[model samples]
Target: MTDVPFTRTETPVLEPITMINAFTVPVEESERFLRRWKSNAEIMAGKPGFVRARLHQSLINGAELRYVNVAHWESGAQLEEAQKDPEWYANTLQMLNDPELHIQARPSIYEVVVEVEPGARLLP
Candidate 1:
């Protein structure tokens, strides 16, 4: 992905969509779970209504925000349909319910109403 600006046309699609933000625990457990999560792409491939999913890690002030997993879909129905899959549910539950991973976070689906793309900055 490029550090590009979101113009008018590119902004609208993101606005009406629902954004899911997932925060994981520290790397010790979070990283391990993440590795497992990514390794099983085959499971996700068969899930219904799976549009796209991406993982993110905090940089500077990250402890307050450990990891972020973003998934975008055509609609909530499609996403929900995928979740109904037994394999998807089992794999997800295993990673999430791991005793070693003491994850503390809340993920909420939001309807994006507006967006503003920031311009280049002097600081990186």
Candidate 2:
């Protein structure tokens, strides 16, 4: 994925929609989980209004959340539409049906309320 520049203009405030999913995967199935998650993320990236997707793994040993997915979208409606697609149900959601994986996922959506960049000063 190409890096997109995020500029904060003082006159206009922009709030990007974000989705975060925390996954707890069995140590034995961590690799498989990563692969499946990446595939799912790729599919979502192809949809309209997809801004960016990122998967983060905890470096701390024995962390409850082994993997976390943080995705940014243009709006909540766009995200809801993408989730309703049949392709998402067939490919991404189906992965959860596998009992062998023993994966637990908790997902949530949020609106970005504040942002700060280095060397950027707030206008008075």
Candidate 3:
């Protein structure tokens, strides 16, 4: 009898939840903060428990763009824990130098109740 060197095995790890939040910026501030915004996104992507994210810029002629940051985590606890790091504060400060950028933001937490199966539909 011999044992295989490699075999399929399952190990349990903390599975996190998906969090979606939107950041609304004034129309006048977009140009001033574009670089800072990209940098912040890159920083968050490098954090632990990060899954994926997308930043959406609004298309409305005169409306400010809303940057939606979505991330999947192992748990709400993990998300909350990682956010307490003081490094987050340093990175966040870089985002505030732009005078045009409104310091105020509207963010919300959501728990997904149901999800529909994915479909392949292209927008026109």
Candidate 4:
């Protein structure tokens, strides 16, 4: 009889939710939007249930969707609470209302149905 010399780590299974926001901005105003976006991101990062966030930029110049933000939260409630932070709200309002930026945003929360990683086998 032989025993494996390894220990398995146990982690809680999470039904996490994702917050995705797609933004349309003029090419010229991208910098301004990014600056304000960074500030807003910082506020979310400090909130509870925030797992992580990534902002993606489109390769095409002057694309309709200039930037897309994808963030993960432990629960929808936590994400909603974080978004209510006064500083974040003010920053978001200012950024969106800035005529120079002319940004349009489509934001929503989603639940992941399935995920496939590279080199992973499909289940039967």
Better of 1 and 4 by lDDT: 4
Write the number of the candidate with greater TM-score, choosing between 3 and 4.
4
- Let me know the TM-score candidate 1 reaches against the reference structure: 0.66
Q: Which stretches of candidate 2 lie above 4 Å from their native place?
A: 1-15, 116-124
Clash totals, every prediction: 0, 0, 4, 0
Question: Candidate 3's residue-wise lDDT over 62-109, tens digit each?
Answer: 554356666676656656665555666455565664445674444444
Give lDDT tens digits, candidate 4, residues 15-105.
6788888898889888989998998899889999999999999999868998999998898777766766778777777777776777778
Q: Judging by TM-score against the true structure, name the best candidate.
A: 4
Question: Candidate 4 has which clashing residue pairs, if any?
Answer: none
Where is model 1 more than 4 Å wrong at Cα? 1-16, 39-42, 117-124
Q: Which should have the higher TM-score, number 1 or number 4?
A: 4
TM-score of each: 0.66, 0.78, 0.66, 0.82
What's the distance in Å from true for residue 28, model 2? Answer: 1.4
Q: Which is superior by TM-score, 2 or 4? A: 4
Q: What's the CA error at residue 4 for candidate 1, in Å?
A: 42
Name the best candidate (by lDDT).
Answer: 4
Which pairs clash in the backbone of model 3?
Answer: 15-74, 16-73, 16-74, 16-75
Worst 10 residues of 1 by lDDT: 1-10
